[model samples]
Target: MIPVPTGARVWLATGYTDMRRGFPWLALQVQEVLRKGPLSGHLFVFRGRRSDLVKMIWHDGQGACLFTKRLERGRFIWPSVAGEAVTISPAQLSYLLSGIDWRNPARKPASDAGRIAAFTV
Candidate 1:
């Protein structure tokens, strides 16, 4: 899990992005396109054109860190249109990274309701 600073926000860049871009390019996007400073310490998430991979960039005081995740069996959920970033909670980010639908983070039971674990019961 990526640790979020005290009150820093997570901004998801809407639409698809070219994953070929590196830190410098992505950072510039944060400033020019997203209209936010890359060094502001806010987490920025960008999805690839195929929606199966995503890149996250954030400044961790000393320097910037870039993290990437690709799903093997499912595509990452993302908004359709472009423009304006989406702010999501850290918990939602966790859901997203785990290949779950972050837009509506929910867990589905792995077994029948009648077979509930004795401990959970």
Candidate 2:
């Protein structure tokens, strides 16, 4: 698992982003559109319109890092709203990348009756 430093924020850019955009362009989106600095050491995540691809950009004091993930089967779960930013924990991010719904994760080991509650991802 990727470790997240204490107090570091993970920002998810709601809706879709153009996957063709590289660091500089995506950084610009973070700064201008998200109203946040790209080099601010905070994690910024972007998802493509197809919902199967996601790109993450972050500055780790040394340099910028970009991570991309694409699902071979199901599409990535995303917020339905547009033009908004949501903050998530590193653990939730891990769940999201695992192709599981990060919002209402499955409750394990106790009962077989499956019930889920909706929450923002």
Candidate 3:
């Protein structure tokens, strides 16, 4: 998980963005298109047109950071609202990154008789 500041807010840019854009251009979009300060310490996330990739930009006071993620199977869920941006919590971002439905996460059963779960590094 990202070490986001406790008070920092996350904003999802509505619609899709060009994934080829770098930090400077994305920062410009955050300023001119979203009407938000790129250096405000808030994190701004943008999804690619294909919906499988996402780009994030944040100013961590000391320097600018650009993060990108691509799903191996499912596409990242997005809002269809006709707005410039939407605000979400850091927890929701984590859920979204994990390919889960951040909008309404369903409960899973505690007992898994047929399946086995394991983690390896």
* Residue range 53-107, candidate 1, lDDT tens digits: 9999999999989999999989888877687789998988988898888888776
After superposition, the stretches of candidate 2 with alpha carbons farther than 4 Å from their true spots are 108-121
Q: Say which prediction, candidate 1 or candidate 2, comes out ahead on TM-score.
A: 1
Q: Model 3 over residues 1-121: C-alpha lDDT tens digits?
A: 7777989999999898989999999999999989999999999999999899999999999999999999999999999874589999999999989989999978788778758979799
Q: Which ten residues in a row have the lowest lDDT in candidate 1?
A: 112-121
- Which numbered prediction scores highest in lDDT against the true structure? 3
Measured with C-alpha atoms, the lDDT of residue 11 in candidate 3 is 92
lDDT (Cα, tens digit) per residue for candidate 2, span 41-101:
8889999988999999999888988999999999877777789899988988998888889
lDDT, candidate 3, equals 0.92
> How many backbone clashes are present in model 3?
0
| Most accurate candidate by TM-score | 3
**How does each model score on TM-score?**
0.88, 0.85, 0.89
